[model samples]
Target: MEFRYLGNSGLKISEIIYGNWLTHGSQVENDTATECVHAALDAGITTFDTADAYANTVAEQVLGDALKNQRRASLEIFTKVYWPTGPKGHNDVGLSRKHILESIDGSLQRLGTDYVDLYQAHRYDHETPLEETMQAFADVVRSGKALYIGVSEWTADQLRAGHALAKELNVQLISNQPQYSMLWRVIEKQVVPTSGELGISQIVWSPVAQGVLTGKYRPGQQAPEGSRAADTKGGADAIRGFLRDEVLTAVQGLQPIADELGITMAQLAVAWVLQNQNVSGAIVGASRPEQVRSNAAAAGIRLSGDIMGRIDEAVGDVAQTDPALTASPARRPA
Candidate 1:
């Protein structure tokens, strides 16, 4: 696998970051999760991204157990805060000083690590003052609980303000984690440019559009059993919008492109995101070990300008490009 510098920092992360969002503690068994993690390591993925909110905090414990034997220095671990975790208590959410400080300790304990390579805000907390949030992050970095800081799904304006405050407090805001893929281009218009100027890189998730870009879901047909859209817990909800006939047809139109490149649809999807110079990494999750290996093959693959144009023409306007579509919750969960 290939590696790239994360933002302007000295840190380098695997281009394909192994992430556990919906599978680890909720959809798949612990043994299965362990196998996937091992597969990622075997595939040369040194970066792992998770969140405290995933599976109500069980995901971190599962990932910790999976990587308990690896040399800690060999990995780049990332986790996030700002979502309601642990029984969803009144004080358990947002980026307030109390929440930020306490969440780091809890995450460290759960992940079985004293410090994480990166800590992130899961979303923009509209209810909390930005100053309070950035200062808390600064303390997190100063105390050595985390090496660098980042935010996910934040607007461009929000990133500018947060980056300015991070500079004032003397901390590094090096990355932005956003939902970016061939089907999701909302970040390209504004966030990409702003982050570029501020010396930040994007670690994009859902590079396969939650499996929609894998050419598994077809137009006017029942979703194949066991697909993400067929999942009932929360997967269906996450991928429902992309299951529209127009979107499915548009996605299927890329089959010829994938065939011509001698790559799978999933690889094409992941490589497509990495083609953007500002993207530092593309996050991929898996239920099976082979899936990890397959997605990892896209790490160093480069698409020419002509292929990119053809892909755009194939997907047409069905892809979501409206900048407004990239958004975070208006308020922290109660």
Candidate 2:
């Protein structure tokens, strides 16, 4: 597996980070989840990313059990806060000092680790003061609960302000996790430029556009049985936007490109995301062990300039590139 430093930090992570967003503790059985984790380790993936809100915290428990016997020092485990993990009390959410302080301990307990390598804010809390949020993160680092800080799905302006505060507090703000794929190019315009300037690398999720780029959902066809689009508990709503005939047909056009390179459409999609210099890792989720093995092959493949141009020509018109689409909702459930 190829590795890269997350942002300007000296810490290195695998190019393909194994993530359990929708499969662990919800869609898949515990044994299946454990098998997938083992497969990732066998494929030389050392980085694992999960969030407190995933599967109502059961994802972390399953992931923790999967990694319990492994040498802790050799792995880079990341988790996030800022979502309602429990009862809907005011203190149960947001990036307030109270929530941050409480959330880290719960996360540590669920993860079966004393500290996470990277602790991220799942989203920018519009209701909380930025200072309070930054100070809470700084406190998390000082307390040795997290080695570094990151944010997910934050706008460029939010990132800049948070980064400034992190610098002032002497905290290492190293990465940003966002939804990035051939179909979603919102980050390229502003977030990437701001993050590049601030020395923050992107650990992008949905590099295959929530399985849409795999070309499994053909145009004008009902989604295959048990696929993401058919599994309501596993990202069905999120994948709905990309289920249009035009998008599916456009994705189909990339099959020949993948055939030419002797790669699966999923591998082509993942390799496409890693081509960006600012992307530290692409997060991939799986329900089966073989899926992990197949996607890991994209770690070292590099696309030529002509292939990239061909990819752009194939899906550019259907891609979502509006910077305005990058903003988070003012009020999430948390």
Candidate 3:
């Protein structure tokens, strides 16, 4: 698998990172989740990303169980905070000093690792002081609970302020995880430029727009049984925004490009995100082992300029590129 340094740090991560966001504990069975994780490992993936808020923290437990036997030194495991995890208590979320300190221990225990390679703030905590948050992260690094720090879905201004605080506190804020794909380009204008200047790389999620770019959801037909849109749990809600007929039809246009490259539409979608130099990895989650293996093939893919233009044209104006579209909760999620 191809690897790239996260941000300007010397630590390298696989181009394709296995993530268990929607599938680990909610959508897929435990045994199937383990199989998918194993498939990722077999495909040469060394990076894994999860969030403690996923499935109310059960995702972390399942992911930990899946990776329990692997050599810890060889893998880059990442998890995040900032979302209400347990009982939705006020103290159960946010980036306050108390929460950060307590959350790390719970995360470490659930992950079955003494330290995570990277620990991220799942969102910008508008209710807390930046100084308090960064200092807590710095302490996490000093305590050897996390080797580096990251943030997810944070805007450019948030990243800049956080990066400055991290520098002052002597912590490495190396990565930003965002939803980036051929159809979701919100990070391109503001986030990417600011991150480029700050030396922070993006480990993007939903590279296939939560399977919308896989060409599986057609324009007129019902969402196929067992598809993400068909699943009423969280997937349906998460993927609802991109379920328009125009978007689906636009996605259908990209199949010919995938056919030309002899790659699946999913692989093409993942590769499209990696084409950006600032993207260190594309996080792929799977409900099945074959999905993991197939998507991992996106690693090291090089799409030509002509193909890129074709993809842009194929998707047309259906892609969302508004910088203002990037956001986090105004208050901690309840």
Candidate 4:
């Protein structure tokens, strides 16, 4: 698999990163997770992304176990902080210094690794001072707990603030993980450009718009029995409302291009995202080994300029309907 430098950082991540969001701790068992990881590694996927909050912190433990017995030196591990991982208490959540410190130790224990290649803040924390958050991350990096630091779902203004704070404090902010996809171009206006200017790479999540671009959830039909949309709470309702028949009809128009390329619609959708230069890696969340194989194969399917244009026009500046939304391009900070 071809590797790309995450923005300007010297560290290189696989073009397709295996993300364990919903599948690792829910749909897939320990053995299945191990099988998927092995399948991904065979396909040249070296990077793995997970969060402490996903599956009540079980995703991290499951992912850690999947690779704990393997050669840890051969893998690039990435995990996120923020979100509540403790019993009902406000102090257990947010990006406060206390949570940051405690969270890393827990993550390290669960990941079965001394250090994560990249540690990311899952979201912004208005309650904590930017300086405090940056300082805590700097300490983690200095203490060798994490190799690099990143932020996710944070606005450009917050990104700029954190970047400037890190600069003043002599800490490096390596990347920003956001929901960037063909259907969700919000990052284009500010987050992408801002992070680019700051020399921060983007490890984009949900590059496929949660399977909408793959044309899996048809407009009128019930979601396929075992799809993510069906498993996720309110997922079917959300998709049915946002992904209308017009969108499906438009999606159908792109099938011919995918056919000509000898790739599935999911591959075409993933390939379309990696076509952009700023994207460091596309996080592919797969429940089954076959899905992982399909996504990994997408790394080689390059869409020509004409097909790219067709994809753009087909989707037509659609807004993301995912509940955990990211910054919107139209409302991006100036």
Candidate 5:
């Protein structure tokens, strides 16, 4: 597998990071999850990303059990905080010092590891002071619970503020995890430039637009059976926005491009995201082992400028490029 340094940091992660967002401990059985993790490792994927809020905090335990036999030093494990993981309480969420401090211990315990290679803020906590958040992250690093810090789905302005404080606190803020895909260009306009300038690389999620880019959901028809859009517990709600006729038709137009490249629509989609120089990795989630192997093949493929242009022409109109779309949710769940 191809590897890249996460931002300007010395830590190297696989270009295709195997992530368990909706599958682990929820959608897939434990044995199935273990098989997928093995498939990823067999395909040379060393980076794994999960979150404390995923599957109500059970995903980490599943991933930890799956990787228990592997050599810990060879893997780049990443997890996130923020979002309510336990019982609903006012202080159970946000990036406050109490939450950050308490969350790390729970995350470490669940992951079966003393430390995570990178710890991220799942979202910008509008209710918490930025200083307190960064300082808490600094404490996480100093305590050796996390080696580096990252943030997910944060706006460029929020990233800049947190990055500045990270510098003051002498902690490394090396990566940003955002929902970036051929169809979702929300991060390209502002977040990408800001992160590039601040030495932060993007580990993009949903590179296939939650399977919409795979051409499995045809226009003028119901979603295929057992697909993400059809799976209520998986991504039905998240995939709805991209299910419009104009968007699906545009996505269908990319079949010729994928055929010409001799790659699956999903591979084409993942490779399209990695073409950006600022993207360090593209996170792919899977319920089946073969899916992991197929996505991993896209790791080192380089798309020519001509192919990229063709892609842009295909989905440019339907793509969500508005910078305002990068804003964090107004009301986070407690």
Candidate 6:
């Protein structure tokens, strides 16, 4: 595994960040979760990404237990806020100042750590003012509960405005988390460019398009049992648009590319996402330790320029029509 800077924040995070969204409290047992976390650390992945809402907040406990005996200073822990973590209630979610402050304390307790390396607002909360969210996150940083701040699934305009607000308040928003993969190229339009301009690196989630680019589901076939496609929680709908025969066929065409490159389709897909200069890291979720090991190897597989061009052509035209997107100039190493 290789490491890259988390945006321009002077923090070097592993290229393959182990995401605890699906495995810890959802599929893997405690013993298995420990095994997977150990495997990631052995493979040089120092970053672990999770969220408060992942599996009713049990994921944090599982991860915390796994790393209980390890040196905390050596690992980079990242978790998100802004999702409902309880029975339906009026103030159960969103980026309100009250929620942000309360959520971090709960996360810290569950993770058994004094602070997380990075804490992100899980998504944009239109109901909450951006200034309030920024100020609350700044307070998190100042209080030493979170070292840095980021936002996930936000529009380019939101990122611009949020960063500006944080700057005014003397707090730096370090990164942006968005879905960017071979199957999802929407970020190429504005988010990537805007982030590049602001020096906020992208820690991309679902870099393989929720396993569609893994070539596991072929055209006109039933999804294998226990696969993400078979899952109902935020997984079923993820691949719904790409469930068509045409999309599956396109995915199948990548087999030769993977074979020629001496890598799995998943590895090829992940490496392709990391090929973009704007991408700081790719968060990979796995149900097993071997899967984590396999996915992390993607960091070493460099896609050739010609193969990248071929991939772009194979995926067909994808329009990025987000109004918040802006054009970006070439990126220079910081």
- Per-model TM against the reference: 0.99, 0.99, 0.99, 0.92, 0.99, 0.93
With candidate 3 superimposed using the best TM-score fit, by how many Å does residue 43's alpha carbon deviate from the native?
0.2
Output the better candidate (1/2) by lDDT.
Answer: 1
lDDT of 3 by residue, 95-185 (tens): 9999999999999999999999999999999999999999999999999999999999999999999999999887899999999999899
Alpha carbon lDDT at 226, candidate 5: 79
What is the per-residue lDDT of model 1 for residues 193-282, given as tens digits with 9 covering 90 to 100? 999999999999999999999999989999999988888878899998888999999998999999999999999999999999999999
In order, candidate lDDTs are 0.95, 0.94, 0.95, 0.81, 0.94, 0.85
Residue range 40-73, candidate 5, lDDT tens digits:
9999999999999999899999999999989999
Which stretches of candidate 1 lie above 4 Å from their native place?
Answer: none
Q: Point out the higher-scoring one by TM-score: 4 or 6.
A: 6
Runs in model 2 lying further than 4 Å from the true structure: 332-334
User: Which of 2 and 3 is the better model by lDDT?
Assistant: 3
Where model 4 places Cα greater than 4 Å from the true spot, the runs are 232-242, 317-334
Candidate 2 lDDT score at position 281: 99
RMSD of each predicted structure:
0.6, 0.8, 0.6, 3.8, 0.9, 5.3
**Candidate 1 structure lDDT:** 0.95
* Clashes within 3 Å, all models in order: 0, 0, 0, 1, 0, 0
C-alpha lDDT (0 to 100) for residue 46 of candidate 3: 99
Clashing pairs in 1: none
Of the two candidates 1 and 6, the one with more favorable TM-score, higher being better, is 1
Tens-digit lDDT track of model 4 for 62-149: 9998887768777899999888885736677877898899999999999999999998998887767778999999999999998888
lDDT of 6 by residue, 1-334 (tens): 8888987688989999999887788776889999998899999999999999888799999999888988999999999988788573667788889889999999999999999999999888877877888999999999999999998887888889998998898877889888787777777788888999998999999888778888999889998888888887667766677677878888888888889888999999899989999998999988889998999899867878899988877776542345444222122111
- The TM-score between candidate 1 and the true structure equals 0.99
